[model samples]
Target chain A: MKSLSLKNLAKTYFDAYKGEHVTAIRDVSLEVPAGEFVSIVGPSGCGKSTILNMVAGFIPHSGGEILVGGTPVKGPGPDRGVVFQSFALFPWKTVLDNVGFGPKMRGVPKAERDAIAREYLALAGLSHAADRYPNELSGGMQQRVGVVRALANEPDVLLMDEPFASVDAQTRMTLQDELSRIWEERRPTVVFITHDVPEAVFLANRVVVLSKGKVLAEVEVPISRPRVWDRLVADDEFKDLSNQVLALVRSA
Target chain B: MERTSRISAALIFIAPLAVLVALWAVVVPVFGVRPQIFPSVPAVGRAGLDSILDGSLLRHVAASVSRVAIGTVLAVLVAVPLGILMGVSRGVSAFLTPLMRFFSVLAGIAWIPIATLWFGYGFGAIVFVIFNAVFFVVAYNTLLGVSTIPMTLRHAAASLGAGRQAMLTDVLLPGALPNIVTGIRTGLGFAWRGLIAAEMIATDVGLGYMLFVARDFYQTEVIVLGMIVIGTLWLLIDRLILVPLERATIERWGLVSA
Candidate 1:
């Protein structure tokens, strides 16, 4: 069974102010097998985030369904975790507490949840920041905490909506490498959304190109792991896949 | 270093008041101001010392402080929960907002006549005025606070598997706290003024009563003493308590730099 599946999902809303119907996404279907990394790339208003929100169950699809581990998603649950573009770290909570929040919500015991939070914080290279508040950290560090926070829930699938878009180029590259390393270790089925083409090609097992709220292409990246920035850029296979994804984005 | 900074901060507050006192001491006698209009600084000080020796000053201070403490505490306890309930539902908040605004604006001294009639003279009337003054303003501010929380933060909490109770304790309460504290500060300002006014009309053993009674004999020294007490008390409450609380809440819960 596919780890995460969107079966002909569609989202439509009436713009009450404008007095017209708006279709954000339509007829979108994709299956992400367990432990696979898929990146969805599109233009700014192409509804990439709308589709991701649907999968995370933050919004109900106007038509069709989303399933995680073959169970239909009724609403947001522990089975699917989301890392938002805003980082969304609770400002009042320390880094440790923010990471521990998911398990605490799930009724995990204090000692056990604290230990789990510490473990994930260490994995994200943020154990040193356990006592620090979210605002005290830099943007890149905050996003890493955001990622580990979702990971701490032990979800079957992780949904990311432009998680790296706000950081600088150097920080973005470092975060990509860190994310790739984490994904390799945890192997949770992932669906990442972004407008950065090279970033899509670099991080995803398969790139799902979106244009005007529709899936334009799903190109496979056969560039072998363990993936690193400089080495991956030098490989011909990486260049070809990046070019193909870029061409599809431009043509749309 | 921390101690020096703390001492300097205290000095910063005290320096201006010291200058004001020096100016008053020199100007009052030098200008030959009539004793009936304003007492000399030494005369007011002697009146303060006499009240302290007789113990009426302590009684009046205790009565005023206790009434304020009781009314404000009761108001906060009730207002916060009701505000959260109303704020959680858009329909309820919209329906109640106008009503709350009307009542809050009508709070404090405007309620004095009705409150004195309803509760009668003394502690009941004064406390009632203080309670109404605090409740409506705090509730309105709390409603605004809870409503202002971004929807995305709530969604994130829900997706993380937070139940209704957890959401309230961990998200809603903490998120609204900065506003609640701010509300308390603002409301207390209204309540303090209302307390003095109510005490003048309805009570015989408060700072306000002391000031009012002094008017009968034209005891400028006693009146000046009462005025000094009122001003000093308000400064202590605002600077020592409310300001620090507001600062701490904003530092802890508010978004960075907000």
Candidate 2:
């Protein structure tokens, strides 16, 4: 059974300034079973982020249905965690507290929550920087904290919106590897949105190519797991999938 | 190293005052300036010492300080929470912002005549003037602060399962604090000046009263001493209290400047 599903998903809004109606996404549908990592890749303004936001329940979809564990998504809840591209770590909170915030809000005891946060921070290689404020950290480190913060909540599904798009290319690759390793261990259902075809193919079991508010193609990655960046990029399977996805995005 | 820098900072601040005093001593004596216009430096010092010995200076200082403390505390207690509540609703803020701006502009010395008439010419009148000066400015600033917090932070908080009370404590209050502290600093400045003006017009005791009463006897030394006291008090409050508080909040919560 699919862990998460979007059936005939659509979103529409009134452009008050322009005095016109705009459709951000329409009739797009996909499903991800538990423990699957799916990435949606498209050109700018293709509404990939909109789909993630809809699944995260941050915004109401104008039409269609989104289900988590076969239940309809009503609104944002701890069951689905989100990592934003901008690394929205609370500036006022320390790294430890930022990671622990979700559990704390759910009324987890201080000791238990801190312990949960510590494990996640360790996974993100941020244990030494736990006491420092978000502003004190590098952009990559802050986004690592952002990832751990979502993970610490123990959500069934993780929704990431171009989570590493802002980081330097080298740091982005490192973070991609780190996130993939963490995903391998935790095995939560993840829906990641990005514009980079290589990144979508590198980290996802399947890449969904979208454009003009609709999914154009869904390409499965035949590259095996426990994938290394250099080895994966050099492989024929990776090249074929990346080229196919790139072509689809260009056409879309 | 920290201590040495701190001491240097203190010296940097004091050096100007030392230069001012030296310039006053040299220029006044060199120009043969009359003490009547600006009291000779020694004469002002002597006058300050005389007030200190007579205990009248203490009384005036105490009176002024107490009125400011009571008025400020009362105003902050009510204004902050009220401002935050009003700020929560765009409709309420839209309706009330103009009223707050109007009242804040009319704050302080503008209220002196009406305040004295309402409360009579003693502690009540002085307190009312100070309260008026502080209340409207603080409330208006608080409203601005709450309104400026990014909606993304609020959404992030809600998505993390923070309820209403948690949202207020963790998000709203902290988010609004930098603006609130800034408002207090500005309001206090207005209130301090208003206090002196009100004391001169309505009250028989306080630094303003001392200055006005000294004018009757042509005691320019006493007037100079009162002015010094007022300047010192305001400087101390701003540098030592409000400024530090404002800096801490902004540094802690503000977006790191690009």
Candidate 3:
């Protein structure tokens, strides 16, 4: 059974200044089963981020519906947690407070919230930075906080939008490994969106390619878990999938 | 060059003041001006010491400071939350902005005649003037602050499971802090000026009254002394308190110079 479903999802931007409408997503639909790591790959400004925002309910979709566990997603709730591209940690809050913010909003007591946050912090390998502010950390470290903050609530589905896009190559690789490890342990349904083909192939069980608000293709990665991206770069299956995805992204 | 000089530059500013003072000490005598018109530096200093010794100076200073303190505190306590509430909602911000800006322009000295008429010539009248000076300015600035916080940040918080209250406490307040503090400083500047003007016109006590009373007695020395005290007090508040607080807020979470 599908854990998350998108049905006839459409989004349009009304250009108030120009007196026109632009369609970013038009009747697009996809589904992710429970505990499956799915990543959506798309060209820039192709409504990939908008798709995620639709799922997270940060923006009102111009039309259609999104469902998680058979209930319509109207607005943001603790059931689905989102990690933003920019790692939008509350600058005034320490890592602990930021991570615990989900539970704190749910009216969880301070002690219980702290315990949950502590568990996620440890899972993210960021226990030492719990008391530090976001500004005090590097880009990769900031994303770690973002990830922990989302997972602290023990969300049913974790949503990530170009989460590692800002990090350097070394940091991105390390973060991918961390994400892979986290997925291996928690088994939460994840819907990650990225433009980078190699990243999608390295992490996702299924890669959905989108172009002009439509799903172009959905390919399943046959690679085994505990991925070593560097080693996998030499594997024939990895190379072929990467080349195909790269060509598709480049053409679109 | 601007950065380096900002780091090292000080005391060059003192030279111009020293020259002005030296010219003051010599110019009056050279021009044969009467002491009543322009008291000598030594005479002003002597009056300053006299006021200090008699304890009247301290009382007047305390009175003015206390009124300003009470008024500004009350204004911030009231203004910030109200401003944030208005700011969070499009309907409220649009509805209140014109009204708030209208009143901000009418802050400080403009309120004097009505304030005195309403509250009578005492602490109430003086506080009313200061409150008017602070309330609208701070409120307007706070509304602006909340509005300027990026929409994406608020949405991000919401997606991360932050509710309405958490969004306010975490994102809204902190993001608006630099502007809020800036508003307080500017508001208090107008407040201090309003306090002095109100005190002169309506109150029997405080620095403005001290200066005005000195004028009645042709005590130019005391008048000069009062002006000096006002300048010094303002400088202290700006340098030691408001400026540092503003700097800290901007450094921690402030928007860039854009």
TM-score per candidate, chains pooled: 0.97, 0.95, 0.91
Interface RMSD for model 1 amounts to 1.4
Q: List the residue pairs that clash in candidate 3.
A: none
Of candidates 2 and 1, the better by DockQ: 1
Q: What share of the true interface contacts does candidate 2 keep?
A: 0.44
lDDT tens digits by residue: candidate 3, B4-60: 785555466567768888999998888987988999988988998888999999999
Model 2 chain B scores worst on lDDT over the 10 consecutive residues at B249-258
Residue A20 alpha-carbon offset, candidate 3, angstroms: 2.7
RMSD of each: 1.6, 2.0, 3.2
Model 3 lDDT at residue B10: 47
| Winner by DockQ between candidate 3 and candidate 2 | 2
lDDT of 1 by residue, A1-252 (tens): 139988998999999999999999978999999999999998888899999888888888899888898899887887888898998888878999999999999889989999999999999989999999888899999999999999999889989999999999999999999999898887888999999999999999999999888999999987788888978868888888899999999987
Regions of model 3 farther than 4 Å from truth = B1-33, B254-258
The candidate 2 chain A region of ten consecutive residues with least summed lDDT is A224-233
Residue-level lDDT of model 2, residues A45-131, one tens digit each, is 999988888887889999999998999998787788888898888787889998999999999999999999999999988999989
lDDT for model 3, please. Answer: 0.87
Per-residue lDDT tens digits for candidate 1, residues B119-142, read 888888888888899999788888
Per-residue error for A21 in candidate 2, Å, reads: 1.1
